[model samples]
Target: MAYHADIIVDENGKTKCGLCKVFIKDSDIYIEDHLKDTEHSDMYLQRLMIQNNIVINGKKISCLLCNQVSDVAEVLHHIDSSSHKGKMSSVKKIIEKDGGLLVLPEDITTVGSKVNCLVCDGWVEFNQEAVKTHIESAKHRRARAIVVQPLNAIFSVEGSSEDLWCKICQVYFENYIEVIFEHVDEDPIHLKNIGKLNLLIKDQNIDIEKYLHDPKEDKALCKRCGIEVPCNIDNLDRHIRGKQHLKNKK
Candidate 1:
């Protein structure tokens, strides 16, 4: 077995970092500083690859939770976790078989691993590229747009503060917001006002229309485009199935 550098310390010590924080170390820093930030530790899982001589090089794997790998994570319908024994082990096996790692980002608080994303629910990996496609994907907008109520209440119309949870691909994140929403700001997104609570989406099916409504009726605005598209589901339907929307549908 290759001893990865991250394994130098078990997951116990790894909890030192928070999912939102970033940590970079100079070679001069002590081992104590390794967990100082959550950046690399989250999306880029660093492990020590040890050789026979006990020397180890730091190896990196794209976060399996980030959804870069082609894996499908499904929530078992109506099975209570209380009755399951070591359930995570089974989930890990399924993900491994798909060449990806399936995991619950919500589990990070206790397990000591930081999730790369919270908004995307773990679909878009922690990179600029995957994020670009995910948000741009119609699926992301539809799921997240419903979240706009919680989002708008907590964030600006521009949606500066939001955490997207995508159960479909199972990645949680910030960048996915930019990918799904149009015209990200020239600034980073923030969720400073949001409490340490998460809202779970219950729909197993992807229904964009159910949540979509005429903004005019509610006097609302689009998080993207910043223009007031018709707030009604009918108008939004036209917008969604329109030329640009259809292109993204593909």
Candidate 2:
């Protein structure tokens, strides 16, 4: 599939993370911080699992939520405990009814320039097409309606409540993000794009600049290099402390 020029494919075919453009990877310092943290780290790992079909040796891969080493297969199940599921359900209802999409904490949603729907925990660039597609998604559409079928409250809607009997009818989910994340992380088709993006960025491809720049947003851009910093705060700190910045000071 032809993607934006920011993605570069190599002979060896091992894809890089920066190419995904879901997260930024301009600075090595930022990359390091990304590897350590939870949110982006989860996104990265999930992308890999879904895109690459990676069979994670869970013993080796630290749990994204708790930082504990768990069996790879059980990791998602472990993280999607009852409390987490309840919170997600509650947040979904709140987003649908109140329209205040604060399902996740402020820090998690505010990291990037894109408008993120915390209900789906997904993001897209700030454009009409992107926003339209996102809002129209099945997940978003399902989230738009807040309905709970009581055990005794029977209606004409045949399968509105009994998801237990029919898996396909299951609308209310528990840790849907975690499941999707794992699947996407293992998908090779997606990984190929990520790999491509990483190569182009590393080679200083100008085409990828669109993903990096957001003129209207101030916090999204870097204060030091005057360039966009896509990664987290630790990376920005490291960038400020780097030899390049140090030399400029002298």
TM-score of each: 0.22, 0.19
Candidate 1 whole-model C-alpha lDDT, 0 to 1: 0.33
**lDDT, candidate 2, 60-170, per-residue tens:** 544322334556765456446574355345434544442444233222224433446755667654333455566556777555332211110112234543321111122
Q: What's the residue-level lDDT of 167 in candidate 2?
A: 17
lDDT of each residue in 112-192, candidate 1, tens digit only: 332233344664332234444555567655655445434332222235455543221223456345543331222123221
lDDT of each: 0.33, 0.41
Q: Give all candidate RMSDs, comma-separated.
A: 19.8, 22.1
Error of 2 at 168 (Å): 38
What's the lDDT of the predicted structure labeled candidate 2?
0.41
**Cα miss at 195, model 2 (Å)?**
44
